[model samples]
Target: MILRQHGPQLLHHIKILKLKKNLDEHLNNLLTSPWVPENTFQFPARGKRNLRFQSQRQTLESLSDSLDIETSSKALSFLKSTLTSEFVVSLCLLANILQSTISVYKILQSPYCDLKSAVEHTEDSVDHFGNIQRTMDVKFSKIFITAKALMSQVCEEIHFPRVAPHQHYRSNYSTKDPESYLRISVAIPIQDDLINQLKCRFSDRKDLLGTLQCFIPASTTETVDAEPLK
Candidate 1:
């Protein structure tokens, strides 16, 4: 969902750049640039698609400087317009939040994952998300600061979008600061959706798995009643 919401612009920019005749050459130049890592421009499919986009973002940041104005001006312009402070900050927050979800997903996808472990991991994830939602102010402060530092590396400053004042005809939220505005508007809603979805998805399975745990020999004891199993 995060990718669906925030990825299109970056992806579009990348696609356009890919069509440019000089993009590859520029990227090759970037690979050898002493200021950036040797693999900075490499977009290998190492894991999930979301992680790939994370890598792509890093690649774009590194390549943005090397893009030839004559050959890739449109792509460079698109990158400049799209990769704003707000976008990068939001992306950082989403990436941090989704990392836990992705870890759980990978575990669940593994052939070795069992029902007991799956239930435990899912519950842990729910708790993790709950903690994030509860402590969003403190949590988002750190994330926002980290994002600001990251943006600084690219020579961009964190700028909040203008929020309209309260009006009878329209609904508006008056926030005292950018952190508060983002915490109220973006982080909270996404965390709420994620927590709710995890609970809804696992609620039934968790109960059933709890009941079925009795069948596992490691879960059984001499005092265990066979009546429930029957």
Candidate 2:
């Protein structure tokens, strides 16, 4: 959920409206170009071939690097200056979160792992991201909005565990355009998808492994009507 869907999706939100293309057509009569060396920003992709998702964090990091260079340049035009510091900071923090997801993915990839442990990791990761969303709301105002929007979208994609409203628990999400209602936390969906996927892949095999472990072969098998032969 984190690497492919939520993480990548979140990175795209942070990059939205920030990366402009065909600057030559938009800006006119600019003296020196605002383009920086590609080496200053771009990173190699780590996605599998033919995969649905690509390297989101890597792309964000590259975009961020480009903006930072442009922001500090005195000769740059309004295009470069338009990339605000707040946006850059939020993208960086989000990229940091993505880096942490690699460890959890590694745990799932290992051979002979416990289902319970995988669920625990999912639970912990969900809770951790929930707390992170809250923290971002407090620390980084710009990030809070983007983070909430990302969570809202991720929740829609991960429609599992069936969130039900109650007295103590209630969903704080709205499907409005400008993201007026931004209180959705996708921790449950993320964890639910993980646990369900794990079970679907491993649960049935558990019974078979148990039977195999406890099996014993007999030296000589008797027929339905046993006969004592010399």
- Candidate 1: where is the Cα deviation over 4 Å? 1-22, 25-81, 101-103, 166-171, 210-230
* TM-score of every prediction relative to native: 0.58, 0.27
* Number of clashes found in candidate 2: 0
lDDT tens digits by residue: candidate 2, 110-187: 676675566667666767665654554353444444444443332322121233454346443534432222213433
Off by over 4 Å in 2: 1-90, 141-230
Global fold similarity of model 1 (TM-score): 0.58
In order, candidate lDDTs are 0.66, 0.43
Candidate 2 Cα deviation (angstroms), residue 154: 31
- Return the top candidate by lDDT: 1
lDDT of 1 at 159: 66
| Tens digit of per-residue lDDT, candidate 1, span 145-202 | 8667666655567766666664564224577777777667666877799889988998
RMSD of each: 12.8, 19.3
Instruction: Give the per-residue Cα lDDT of candidate 2 at 176.
Output: 45
